[model samples]
Target: MKPVSILFVCMGNICRSPLAEGIFTHITETAQQQHRFHVDSAGTGGWHAGNPPDPRSMEIAARHGIDISGQRARQVNTDDFERFDLILCMDEDNLARLSQSCPPDLQHKLHLFSQYAHGTTQSVPDPYYGGADGFLTVYNMLFTGCKSMLEKMGADDVAS
Candidate 1:
């Protein structure tokens, strides 16, 4: 079977989304199920395109043993709607931006990254201007959200 393809999106791609991609990749790799998934990230806008994730994001990910240093920022494209099995945006604004451009037939694949989080907040806040602590908080949220997303996809069997 083809591996499930997931794309994480945010406004700048240098913060939240890249962190989510790294965290999700780490979880799958740790579970020895990396082969079952393909993960990537992008932003709703191209302002940060070609840049690596924000330094703060890389720092927090490093603390968790995940490196996001190699990931570069890109903007969401029409192709992404068809390329990924699931497209998860970090906040409602990003989701709304996607909703506007996504083809109707592919709308089903678009979702809030927090939908599977099982947390009180349904959106992942941007931490670009904040301190290290904000990155840490976003990391924890993505950790929980990624795990829950896998479970919902019935990929929890491999999450062990």
Candidate 2:
């Protein structure tokens, strides 16, 4: 089977989305299923393009043994819709923004990342301004969500 390509998106790509990317990447690698996936992250806006994930995001990820420091911000574009099997937005607003530009044929690929995140809220709250503790909270949520997303991909047998 072809590898699944997944894109994580948020408003700025500094905190939530990148953290999701890192958590998902860590999950796949930990399960030795990384070869079955292609992971990347971007934002709805380009204001933080080319910038690394927020420092607090980095700190929180490092605490969990996942490093997001290497992720640079970028804006979501039409190419993403075509390239990813799943283009998951961190929140409804970003999902709506992506919906406007995503090609009609590929619109089915867009989803709220938290949809796979059972027990968590329907959206992954952005933690950019909430403070350091917020990063920790967001991290746990994304960790659970990413694990669920992996299971949803039929990798449940190996997702533990």
Candidate 3:
């Protein structure tokens, strides 16, 4: 089967999005199901384009044994609509913004990251303003959502 491609998107890509990418990739790899999917991240805004994820985010991820240090910020591209099996936005504004950039045929691929978390369809709160604890909080939520996403992919069984 072809690998499913997932793109995580946020406003800046310095914190939430890259963290999701790293965490999800780790989950897939550790489960020995890396071949099932490809993961990447981008931002809705271009202000931090080409910049690496923030230092604080790196530190927090490092504590969790997942490193997001290698991720660089970039704006979501037109081609991502075609390339990704899922383009998951961190919040509603980014979701709306991505929707405008997405073509009609590809619109169905866009989703809020929290949607896979059982009942919640709310936004993943931006952790840029608070201290490290906020990033950790966001990390746990993303981990939950990503784990759920992997389960939905039937990847849990594919590895066994």
Best candidate (score: TM-score): 3
| lDDT digits (tens) for residues 11-88 of candidate 3 | 999999999999888888888888888899999999999999988888888987888887899999898999999999
Q: What TM-score, over all chains together, does every model reach?
A: 0.94, 0.94, 0.94
lDDT string for model 2 (55-135, tens) is 999999898888888789999887788889998888889989999998888889988887745744488888887988789
What's the count of clashing pairs in each model shown?
0, 0, 0
Those runs of model 2 whose alpha carbons end farther than 4 Å from true positions after fitting are: 119-121, 156-160
| TM-score of model number 1 | 0.94
TM-score, predicted candidate 2 vs. hidden true structure: 0.94
Using lDDT as the measure, which candidate wins?
1
Give the least accurate 10-residue stretch of model 2, judged by summed lDDT: 113-122
Higher-TM-score candidate among 2 and 3?
A: 3
